[model samples]
Every structure is written in structure tokens, then in C-alpha cells.
Target: MTGARTADPPYLASLRAGYDRAFEATVVATPPEGVVLSQSLFYPVGGGQEADHGTLVTPDGIRVAVVDVRRMSGAVVHRLEKGGLVRFRIGMTVRGEIDWARRYTHMRLHTAQHLLSALAFDRYGLRTSEAAMSGHGGYLDLEGMLDGEEPIRRLEEEANSRYFTQPVQVESAMVSRAEFEAMPGRSSAKSLPQGISSVRLVLIEGIDRCPCGGTHVLSTGEVGRVRVFRDPKGKVASTRLSFELLEEREGPSSPP
Candidate 1:
């Protein structure tokens, strides 16, 4: 926690600036689990989103593969592969670069999840209980029952319509916890830790506004086409809806 500060890390701080794939930071602490940087662009695993995989290059030209990232005691820890610990020392400058292909896919799938979740909540009064994102697709577990394929079909149609036709813009902002709680239709506020005084809200234009820490695309159009389906393994009390982005003629794209 040598360089730890109360302000948001580089990954969260740059989210509104369209985020960064690479960054230069100084090694501030070397904990038993991993190394902490003065600033970092690697996203740690949280909010149902996976951690970012990347590489950290030392000033002396040794490349250390970052296998995992996690937030520990208010610090972002970049866990490196074996033998990487000896290559870095406190106060040394290093360059970090995230795996863009994997990160871009995450951005697309995460935004698509938001659209689908918003639609489900508005159309059927369902609340999203859990979500998991992957390179190929993602899924959202709703708190209520969603019977049959008709609802899934309709949701899929609505999501694609918004993506291809209307193309809603996505934006994010940091707000006081009190301000966020006062806002209408706020969800999952109580689940946040009591020490967090600020909340980050992701707005999908007029469609959705909820508390989220995950990365997302700048617009719905970047999600391409989506395919929504019901997961049979969902709990009896809740419905799990999964989605995959269809292949586009333009192929995979990155967020700006």
C-alpha cells in the first residue's frame, strides 16, 4: 500500500476518457500475492467481470506475464507468472499492456448484458441477480421466473433493434453515494461496501442507468447483433438469460 491513494485507479479514472490499453506506472509495493503499481490500466476482477490479462515490462526489458489481477486492501495487485517477483523492485518504472482482443470482446458483451438486463427489468419487472462475462458471450440471472422461449425471443429482438436501428450512446460518471441512492431506479446499492462513498453509474442513454464498475462500449452499435437464449441450468426460483454477439461483416472491433 505504499502508493495507495483514495482516488480511483487509472483503469477506472480513464473509463470516461474511453480507457487505455497500455500505461506506464511505477512499482510501489511487492506483496506476497503480487505487485502494486503507482498507476495501473489493468482491470481487476470484480462486478461479475473477469480480470484483465496482460504483460508488465520492466525498465531493464524483462517481460513479466500478468496472469491475474485483483483488488486487495484498496490496491490493484498485478499477479505475475512464476519467477517474475525477483525481476521487479519497489520504485522501478514499468510498462503495462492489456490483451486487447480479450478486453474488446469483454466490452461488447458487457454492454450487451446491460441492454438485455434493462429490457428485462422494464418489460417484466425483473431484477438482475448475477452476471458473468466471457470472451464468447455472457449471461444474466434474473431474480424472477421467465417462462418459455417467447420472452427470450422478444428480448433478443428488442436488443438487436436498439443496437442496429436506434444505436444508443453509453456514458459513465462518478457520483456521491448519497446522490446515487437518491436517483430514481437505482439498483444494487446496498450490496456495495459501506466504506465506498462514491458510486460509478453506467448510463445506456434513455434505456438504462445502474451502478456498475465493469467496462463497456461507447455505444450500442458496437455490440453488433446479439442472440439471447435461456439457460436450462438456472435455479428454479430465477431465470438465467444468456447472450452471444453474432459475427458481423466488419468482424470484431475495439472501443474508442
Candidate 2:
């Protein structure tokens, strides 16, 4: 199968493929105790840290816990847990399983961060230069020097307004260089990957156009509820916007 970066595109978890039988895979190479799977739905840890967690089920009815998922030279490598090694092997077809519950939650939270960042940039013109995902939460570093409570509160309001209105739509597409360029206020050339032949553009309709290699939902509504845990006393001008997606709530009782 063509190495469709499609898996990493935002909204893939909400994608039908996630619920389908194992997607597609090819035997890459055999390691000491496990096998390397090519074209895996598993997202190996990249950018900073936090590896993807899941399990790999073998044809022999044995399951190996995917302790660590990482990347090297464009290939995703899964390290199996001890005592679960025999179940997996090179040249053997196995089912790649992900903790959808955990993975989906991450997708929702991650997308929420993007939306919040876009809001800050749009309303306050904050210029963010770096970001990283940690276990506690994710944070972005902006160049803007800020010091006050009002600014933080303002950012919260802007994000909640569009969020509640359900205006954001996270969609993906594989477009040519020209098509990618047509989007308004698109990331400039200096930000783009060098020698890029084709690009995958993830559009946050009406807000931002980002070249992202991560899973996301079809629409902003799927994000359920968002909690912006902004830290006003953040050490310098840099603001730390920690957030999480609230679990879906049950419907209330209907009137008699």
C-alpha cells in the first residue's frame, strides 16, 4: 500500500478506518524480540517525546503490549513487552491495535490546543515559535512578552466563543504545491519543509491552514467540551495554555 500519510491527518480516529479491521501493514524487518511494521496506524513518538501506546496481536492468539512506539528514517517501530515476544515475528501478519479510548482523547485535546492557539494569534497577534507535548499537558511558547491576568482571560473568551458556536472544522487533503498555496494566510515558505514535493494540508476552516501530521476529528463538535487551563503567572512573556477535552455528557430527562 502507498505510504499514505493519511493516518496522521487530523480526524483519523473519528475515521471509519479506526473501527475497521486492521488497516494495512507490511513486514519491514525483524528485531531481537519483535517485528517492525510498515504502514502502521501506530504513531511513533516524534517532535519531542510521549510515545504512542497500544498492543500488537499476533496470528497465534497471543498479544504483545506495544510498550514503546518510535520513529527512525520514516519507519514506525514498535517495541513489544517481555513474555509477549513469541507472538510476533517478521513476515507474519499481525493486527495492530491502538488504545482508541486513550488515543481519541489525545486527538481531541491536541486539536483543541490548535484552535486555542489560532484564537490567540488572531485576536492578540501572538507569535508562537515552539511547542511540545508532555504527560501533564501540551504548551506553546510565544515570542510576545506578556504579564497580566486580563490577557489570559481574553484568550479564554475568544476560544470559547468560536468553540461553542461550532464554527471550526478540521479536515484533511493531499494537495499539490499550488493548491496548498491558495489557502489564505498559509504558513510561509520558510516554515514549510525543505524540498517539499507534495504537501498534506489540514484546514481549520475559517481560522487556520496548517500542515499537520496528526490525527483529528471530522468537525470541531466532536471535540465535545474544552477546558482551557491557562496559567496567568507563567514565568516570562511566554503563556502556558494547558487544556483537556471533557468527556461527553449524558442527555437530560425529557419532560413528561
Candidate 3:
């Protein structure tokens, strides 16, 4: 039952820039499902990405666990664990911090998807029909077939070689809907709803550009080496590339 507010939320702020994992904001309302913060960095579930889990600390030092986040009716609702709702109230100030390990893994996996999708489209004229990411790994379903394991091996090798040698930088920006629609290899933007005049495009340097609202690493190097293979559950017409970050000496570890 939170009323409308004008302040830009933290997730939107980080949408085109570096992510701020922790933030402080006022509680605007406490609906039955969760607390509505005046501003929050927690990413709600959307764009085939998972919601961010975190903790919210009240001004009086009581720590409440934020078990889930969702965007409801234009507001970001931070759902608390059972019995944690009583610690918050309208107008109360709180500090929120996301689970960095999970968020970072998501960032890496998401960027890896973009990389692999770009490679597939560029090398084989295949378009990504779907993509989903998790702390464990991610997958992209392409509109074409890989024919055999050799193509998969080549795709994986090219992705890893680019990561180690070229290290493409990833960045996001807002473009006019017209510009987004005009860009080549932007089949993904076709799914965007109407009335959106502007679109956020995630660009992997010279590699690819696509409309996306998910968090990503700053560079392909941060994604480290990836293992790209055929998904056993893929449909008959489409080829699914299942991928995960291989553990590297300097890269983030896979979630347990």
C-alpha cells in the first residue's frame, strides 16, 4: 500500500553504471508481502535473471534478512524472512547489503551469456531465442543447430581465447528505441513492450549490442574461462549452449 514516490531507485541507477551492492533508504511502507524501501539496490526478479538476496539493518541495529525481491505495480518490494517484517515501519531508515558472492556470480554468468550469444550469431548466423542465468551456471538457446560437437568446441575455444587475449570491455547505455530497433543482430529487442521510447543496450565492446536490463561484469576477462556445451534438455529445432565459469586462480568461485 505504498504511495507513489519520485526518487529514482538504486537498481535503475546501477542499470547503466557500476553496481552499488549496499545502500541506505527510508521505509515508505510495509505491505503484507514485504517492506517498500524509499530506494534499494536489490535487483528484483526479471530479464531471466534471479532476484538478489540480502540483509536489511534497521536504525536501531536489528538485522532482518531480505529473502526475496520483486517489482510489484511499479515498486520494488523487499520481502523479509518469516518474523522479520515486525522490525520495519513506514519512515524508518534502514541499511541494505546484497549477498555479493551471489550477485558477482550472476554478473559473470550474464556477461558470459552475452559473449556466447554474440559469438554464435556472428559465426553461424544463429540468434538467441532464450537465456537464463543462475549462481551455478547459465544457458542460451539459439535458433540454429550446432550439427556436431566440433562447432561447440570451436565456440568454447573462441570464447575463452577472446577472454584471455582480447578481454572485451562490457558497458551499458540508453539509446532511442529507433536506434535500438535499427541495430543489426538485435532480434532480442523485438520482445520489448511498446511505449518504451528508450532502451538500454549492453555492448560488449566491438563484439555485440543487445537490449538488456541485467547486471554484468565490467569486462569479458572477469568472466574468466567458460565451458560451453550442448544442453541435454534442449528442444529439437534449437541448440542450447549450457555454460559455466571454470574455476581460475583469480576468478570468482562457483557458488556451493
Candidate 4:
């Protein structure tokens, strides 16, 4: 399949009410054979994890198989099987639906990661590197060593604290491409692209303001509970931090 193209929609942030408007959308671009769904909720694999897996539907009421999804040039692209592609054209609208089970898992894990980033900064004055959301779980690379279990446990506790304290809010703003390039911490970043009018910033209540293109839960509490799993390699210089979602009862909290 060809490289994915950036779509105007932001799957991670654009989600508000589920199934707001399901309709037929035509393929705006010349997609590869057997492809469907010009726009989708499937998040292409990036950051260190695999892409999303789901199905697609054609305008003629045909079901196309979405074998994989990926991100390209700020747009999310869906790759289909051989038979999935048809003689699609621009302005052709195809109905799109994501695997909610998989998407929700990713949402929870991604949000948990931000909370983990906040925990690292809040407790030990550490910063995160190389964060990823996966099917089984999620992981965030740390610049500092694990030191010990105490720090990890403490970070987990703080992450939960932030999750329950307030609602999570994410907003996007358009800035001059030059201004975006000059933003603090934008230079050292590895995953982000330079020079763009729109920047998607994620804020976890009183937590953080980092650029991200990943999907997240509407509220931090929606992440449920999180537990950090430490890698046994246990290299103090660098370590992989993983997390698992725990089911929790929702208390009365306002969503942002």
C-alpha cells in the first residue's frame, strides 16, 4: 500500500459524542485497491506500537477489510486488503467505523501515559522519552534510570492522584509554521514534525502541555486505574516503564 496521507480530522482529539454522524463518504483520494473509508478512527501504528486493526464499508454497501492503519503527513490512513480497494474516486464518501474495543483500550493506555509523564516530572523531576500505546499495554521510555521500585510505585500513586483530581482537557490551536518551530522543547523532540499551523496540545488538568497526536479518554478518570510494570533488565541508566489499566468506579467528577 502507498504511504498514508494526513487527513484534516484528528482522531485522538476530534472524538466527542460517539457515533455523532455516521454517513456515506466517498474516497477523496486515489486509494490503493480494495480500500474504503476515506476517514477513520483507526490510529496507525507509531511511537513504537502497532497500527490499529478494523474493517471498512463501501458506498455501495460493500464491506472492505481494513487490514491496517497508519499516520502520514499528519493524516490517518487506512490500508485495506487486496479485494478491499475498488474504483474509488475523489468526493466519494464511505461509512467508517472503528473497532471500539481496541480503540478504547488505546485511549485508556494513552491517557495513562500522560499521567505517567506528569508523575515523573512531579515527583523526581524527570522527563519522559519515547512513549507508546499498544494492544497489550503501554510503555514510556525514561531519560533517567529507574533507581528503584519506590520511585516507580510513587509515580504510579501520583498518576492516580492526578487522574482522580480533575477532568482532562485537550485543545488545538493554529500558529504560524515559524512560531511552531521556535516553541520551547520542539527542537529536541524526535516524533514531531516541524513547521505546522495547527498544534494539538494535551492538558491533564494541572498537569502538562505537550504536543501529541494520539487518542485519549475524555477524562483522566476514564483511564480507570494504572499500574506501572517495570522491566527486569533493570538497567539504572535507562529502563522501559509499562502500564496496565485497572477497572474503577466513576465518582462524580466534571469532564472538561
All candidates: CA RMSD (Å): 2.5, 5.6, 3.3, 4.5
The estimated TM-scores of all candidates read 0.91, 0.78, 0.91, 0.76
lDDT of 3 at 236: 85
Q: Candidate 3, which segments miss by more than 4 Å at Cα?
A: 5-7, 10-17, 164-166, 248-256
**How displaced is residue 166 in candidate 4, in Å?**
6.2
Model 3: per-residue lDDT, tens digit, 1-256? 7463425454443443335667789988888989988877787888878998989999989988988998887678989999999999888989998887777778788888888988999999999989998766889999877898999999999999976235777777888898877777846556888899998778888888878878887778877778888987988889999998786323333321
lDDT of 2 by residue, 203-247 (tens): 677887666666555566656655566656555767666655445
* Model 2 RMSD, rounded to 1 decimal: 5.6
Alpha carbon lDDT of each predicted model? 0.80, 0.59, 0.80, 0.61
Give the per-residue lDDT digits (tens) of candidate 4, residues 1-256: 3553444454544545221223344564554433434565566776554666666665667766667876655456677777555535556667776665666677667777877876776676667767776664777777787676888887777677756335566433445445555765412344467544566665556666566766666677667667787866534576778887766443223323
Candidate 1: worst-modelled 10 consecutive residues by lDDT: 247-256
Off by over 4 Å in 1: 1-7, 14-18, 164-166, 186-188, 248-255
- The TM-score between candidate 3 and the true structure equals 0.91
Q: Model 4 residue 197 lDDT?
A: 59
In model 2, what is the error at residue 138, expressed in angstroms?
1.8
Candidate 1 vs candidate 3, TM-score winner: 3
lDDT for model 4 comes to 0.61
The reply for model 2, stretches above 4 Å from the true place, is: 1-21, 24-26, 32-34, 47-49, 134-136, 164-167, 177-186, 229-237, 248-256
